[model samples]
Target: METREHSATAGPDVAPPVLTRIPARMDRLPWSRFHWLVVVALGITWIFDGLEVTLKGAISGVLQEPGTLHFTSAEIGSITSFYLAGAVSGSLIFGYLTDRLGRSLFFFVTLAVYLCGAFLTAFSWNLWSFILFRFITGMGIGGEYAAINSAIDELVPARLRGRIDLIVNGSYWIGAAIGAASTVILLDPAIFPVDVGWRVGFGVGAVLSLFILFLRRHVPESPRWLVIHGRSDEAERIVSGIEGQIEKETGATLEEPEETLAIHPRKSFGFGVIIRGMFTLYPKRSLLGLSLMVSQAFLYNAIFFTYALILTRFYHVPAGKTGLYLLPFALGNFCGPLVLGRFFDTIGRRQMIAGTYTVSALLLALTGYLFTVDLLTPFSQTALWTVIFFFASAAASSAYLTVSEIFPMETRALAIAFFYSLGTGAGGVVAPWLFGTLIGTGSRMAVFYGYLAAVVLMLAAAVIEIRIGVKAERISLEKVAEPLSAKK
Candidate 1:
């Protein structure tokens, strides 16, 4: 448990180098209640995001009713864009803070922000007010993406990081399913007034966030983040406590970790370091991260945000009944990661990421053609989407996984935030608005053309993966990409 701090060979003015085994100690521990606690507490971020999004999509039609806000399809799309804009800004602000401050601090802060935004959304009086509140809610969830992914990846054992991350990211659909199911009752005219029902739907997310905030109080700060920030003593204490707790729970002694890393511990890393790491130190990885993130974000956001609209506009499905179609779609999205996650750790990242992206793209293209030709019934179209997203979900989740684990520790959170913001900004913020406009045109061919664009991006990303994807499966994060401050 000893951490040695000594002057670097370079000079006295330089930050002292800390030689520590915190990462190995964490990676070698047996899976226990502690890991599950981390999963449930931090993993729920995706669920909340899924709920927020699905609720919005499911109620798009309801909001257009005269009893509600009377939003047009184009306005609904713009609202989704506003949410993405908030998320992009939040990720940048909180991501820098998470890297500089600590992961544990921001977890509570971001969730609290989301709670407030969701609660306020229930009381919005007009379209502008609703859009503003949704933006605020997006900020919280966006911050959660940067902080929670960094924290979870740092805390989990290296051997299990891949599957665990995929499962956790995939759990977004659990919230999607919940949102879809609840809207069925919440939006039903017989059960609640149209305006009141949509308001209650948003309130549900606030209540869920409150419970998750309580659970997060039990989760600890990441030892890896602590050690890199010149808090080696605190990191040692936390790791030892984790080891002791796990041993006590299992009633068995733990083995010593053989690996140790030497890093120059600094109080904070400047943006210059992040800029260099991304541009100078790891340009290829930067390209890879962006490609994966942008492709998936474009495909998912464009489709999911506009899904209910397509159902109502094209297939003439009832607004209240959209949730039933979404239930199966959500299930397919969830099951893809749960089922295919292990392969990323076994078959390896390059093959699986490339394979899934390519397969999903091909499927989507086929489905788009079917829709354009007017061959799909609403049930058949939903069935096709359920199948397509089965692969697309896994591909999308892997994008997050790749970005989080492929950067230096000093910049991990910010790197995640940067790529997430850039990709989401480029792909996510525009997709919903663009697709909404297309759907508003009332042309299946126009919508099919949009799907074709998404397919092109996915194919290009798959090619990039085949060319340069990291062999990160089952590898320690340190080995995946060495820390910027590491001393050879």
Candidate 2:
């Protein structure tokens, strides 16, 4: 059977449908069925990924009604923090589990947990209830990085990995865009009540999980994992299936028939293995991981969570128009990789890492000045906001690309969770709180203080990378090698 996109939506939920048609090969790499399966799975996970954030972004709209979950700002922050904490825990735990167990079963586990959270979030009557639900959702989201990335990393050839990874990760923003836009599209006080709109938004996200579950049946575990785990029988079976699919759709012939080769199995899976596995991979990678996490957390939270709030709270823009204004920010996110990802391989991951973070930091700093001094009008502020976010998204995607690739196969998932929790989840949890609290304090100056600090920190990392590049950025994935080839 030919595989299609996991879900064809604006973000990861919606994939660019997979066809039975065989993709032409560049070099020896033929487009294979297994590869497509990995792509769709990641994309679907990402679609729900956006829904998680969009639901939170539209909280103000939901709470407008008198009886719906009346909660204080601090309380709201605490609840949101739980979601982030859950994601963090999920990522760390799942990363090791994927390495120890396999990607196959864990995918279902994550999705199932996420679905439970999504429904509970939609049905929750109070703020705390929503938080509890959202925490479950976060755990799924946390597992998302380790599980999806591990599956794709193992299956997709290194050459195409950079571009594919960027595309895969970039879909999250598209998810965010569609999710945020849905809030505006479904805005009807008469037909769709405010709280109901938010509920529907989450329900839409959760409903997507079901269709993806259907697609999951078509997905097999990574053949590489099979080979690593001493499951050559299953690996060969999967390889044969993929080859058969390729031959059917693309009319391509394999260079050789699938043959049994001695599979080199890793040591037994255990908690000690993950702990030792990470350090054995190179101690510096962990430091790079930490920096990436800190930079990514601040940059993402600053933009996605805060941008819509800026339009509504500061500029007095209507809720509907806020989505439109934020559209540029989302579009900026989608375009960043298309423009900069080409450099990940050529300039080498290190240089692109430095350049992206450096430029993003600079752009953000300028955004602060523009806002701080009141240089930009309401219109320009929004436009400038989008411009900065464009670079921020690029920086974030690039950061993850490097972070995901550097660790040893044994610790890859665990390392990703370790860094990602501090970086992405921390950002998601805090961005709203920091901005909301500081802004509410009647100090517009707080935006400058907060963002300026982020800029400086991000730039510092770029500078360090310039001096001595991290190994992950230097090791290019073989699959997307051509796409990231040096620009002339």
Candidate 3:
């Protein structure tokens, strides 16, 4: 297969159209060590996010101890909100920059920012300092979401995109489990001093990030992004390198791709173009993305962030043992995506997305009813939550999958950032704070009502998904959403 580039100088303002085989070349390649490298390097973003969130949740009780920060429940909730606020800001800022700069550049920059924030968090002297550092950490993870997802979707083969995306997103719980398990030792009174243990927990995230930075150095920029941005020479060189690597690993001749894409290469897309394309051109897709993101964000943020408090406040479970309970919850969440991810590709996106969302909602309603009736112990409560989130985790993972693939390549990262920022800003930023205040009231019914609201939003998302979700299974990204620069 050969790339054919033709410069169509229709006008001074218009970009020259270049017909290239980059997309088909990427989509048809067999899975190999190169793909695995991409997964490990890029997918670790979600793991770090999971670690940051679970670390805070695990240490919330420790922060409230008189010997430590002695923060109230409301203050703990506010700290979570501050982190999410920073995420919203970071996604918007870096998401656009990732599009303008390059995927390879921002992933490293974001990880470095996270390392700085997390390391600084270990030495926070007061409530404000802790919140400030946490906010900075959230910004890094938020930026990761936009840059990493776009890069993953572009590089991975079309046949495996759905499952790979789901599994990568699901890996967040691996970090969650790590955070929970580490706290069991870190927060223990016998193992470390009351204040010292919580500090080490923050340091763990920083240390892990420092390691990932070295690994990501080997990953390359997106060829698709390059070709469209008038860097076809670089794009061709990178794709040729990847193809050679994959062929060498398998020791087999690679088949040539049959299809090609024609793109009018440009320097960058304006924010206004992305906004108009998402809302004006793809309205239903925009709504579907928003609903899925908002519902899952609210459900996960509300329940997960405040779960330790629910145990301590209602069931009187000791704060030190909360990590033990979270272990099972994290296992259930991690397993959900691993088990159900393949079905997404086989069963199709529309059906699987709708089914998972609807099922999780119904399960949540039942669990909330059980809690309100006061017939369950801590063990039973955790058990039921584990079951509910089994499906909920998959549902949440699919939300990221939906937004990333359904838009034009030029707009992909910004679109993810826009929806993530909007959805997270609207739902995630307030859920923890709201649920924490509700849990503070010592009323099971109040907390149950919060769960009920999440159910409503989730069920609504299911209906919208059933109505208009894209059937993108096994389809090339270029085919799913034609590039904004594509020429007739």
Candidate 4:
């Protein structure tokens, strides 16, 4: 084995390529406080995202009031679309940077961007400023998804990867639950003025985000990424530090790592390589990734983003009271992944993913039919969605898990960004616009049609999973897909 640094601006900078034990060292470690720190620091981004999104949904009705920004229904939907647009743009721009610049750098940069956008959103005076600020916030979150998912997958032992990834992704709903409850208090007429309440919602997200910044600074760079990017010495040092800490924490000597991979350390990898890898080298996995991403994005953004609007518009639920309903919905979503996550590792990815997706789709169809027939009260409607999303949430989280693990390590962040941007573009951005239009029509059948569309996409994703889902459970990422930089 050899370790050396290469300088930038030297043409085709290359170091002595050799076998490295970094990935094996990481994968063989026992559960330790270090893992918890990584989970909390990087995983908390989902919570902030959930908080940002739920706060927006919770305050959507407030924004429509005469005393507030007085946004129209279409304007409300447009705001979500703007957020998705910014996310798409950010994922592409920052995701490439994440792969190029390293995970640790982008996580801090992205969070700072989010905090700025979120704080500025509190001061929004008009619809334009609010939407613009939301877009900026979305950009921050979009980048977080790219960087954090790659880091988590790379660092976690393959045995625990599925459960941890699902649980971390599902933590979004814990923040959703918090945002929903907070909105109930903030939007209360006795507690705060209608105009004042909504600004406070955005302010709370920004404030909470600040605490996460301190924790993120402690999480180290991915050792896998480091070794592959011509920084083997740093990778070795970081991994060794983690092992020392883990042994101290557990008070046990660690076993030696048995597997090591030989990799060529390249200073630069081009987009052409990634593009060719996706389309030519691994085509089926690419399709599977897209299918999962698109379906879940459409379903979640279409419904969750507009829950308040639907309650206020059709169900006539009070704006302030919307959180009460969303509370239960959030609970169901959060619990799904926590409870069902282990199955992805134990029962296997294909069966569990397909089962969850199929069941959720069926429930959505049933709920849509009942909704169109005017048989559901606001309480019952929420209850049905709760049951539906319980499964859907786990399935949705799996989509992220799938993309992160199935691709070559060299292109992992970009692949996630590609699928997320593409999926969110096709499903996430468009669904909100379509649903907002449907809800504005004041026709139950129109909204039912929207539900049916979600059903079809989910069903397609389920079928795709059954046919081509990678049995990636309990398998190291390098085994899942050989690293692009692996020496022949």
Q: Which stretches of candidate 4 lie over 4 Å from their true place?
A: 1-12, 309-316, 439-446
**lDDT by residue for model 1 (1-488), tens:** 65556663734323677777788888888899999999999999999988988888778888888888898978987898889899998999999899889999999999999999999999988889999999999999999999999999999998889889999999999999998888768977899987899899889889988999999999999999888777888888888899999999999998987778888877777889777977798899999999999999899988887787899998889866777888999999999999999999999989999999999999999999999999999999999999999999999999999999999887888889999998888677778778988999999899989999999999999999999899999888999989877853
Q: Supply candidate 3's per-residue lDDT for 29.
A: 94
User: What's the TM-score of each model vs. the native?
Assistant: 0.95, 0.85, 0.95, 0.93
Lowest-lDDT window of 10 residues in candidate 1? 6-15
Clash counts per candidate, in order, are 0, 20, 0, 0
lDDT of each: 0.89, 0.68, 0.89, 0.88
Q: What lDDT tens digits, residue by residue, belong to model 2 across residues 1-488?
A: 12323432323222233222111221134657657777886667766786677657666645645756777756766776788888888898887787778888888888888988997888988766877898899898889788888677666655566766777777787787787677665666676866677778778778888778778878888765554454545666776777778788888776752322222244345667567556653566667767766876777776666765666666778865676776667787878876777667566777777877888888888878878786776689867766776666667776677667766555667777778877865576666668766666655688789887788779887876676565443232322221110111
Q: Which residue runs does candidate 3 get wrong by more than 4 Å? A: 1-9, 65-74
| Residue lDDT tens for model 4, 383-467 | 9999999999999999999999998887899898999898889777688779978999999999999999999999999999999
Clashing residue pairs, candidate 1?
A: none
Worst 10 residues of 4 by lDDT: 1-10
The CA root-mean-square deviation of candidate 1, after full C-alpha superposition on the true structure, stands at 2.0
Which model, 2 or 3, shows the larger lDDT?
A: 3
lDDT of 3 by residue, 432-470 (tens): 768978998999999999999999999999999999999
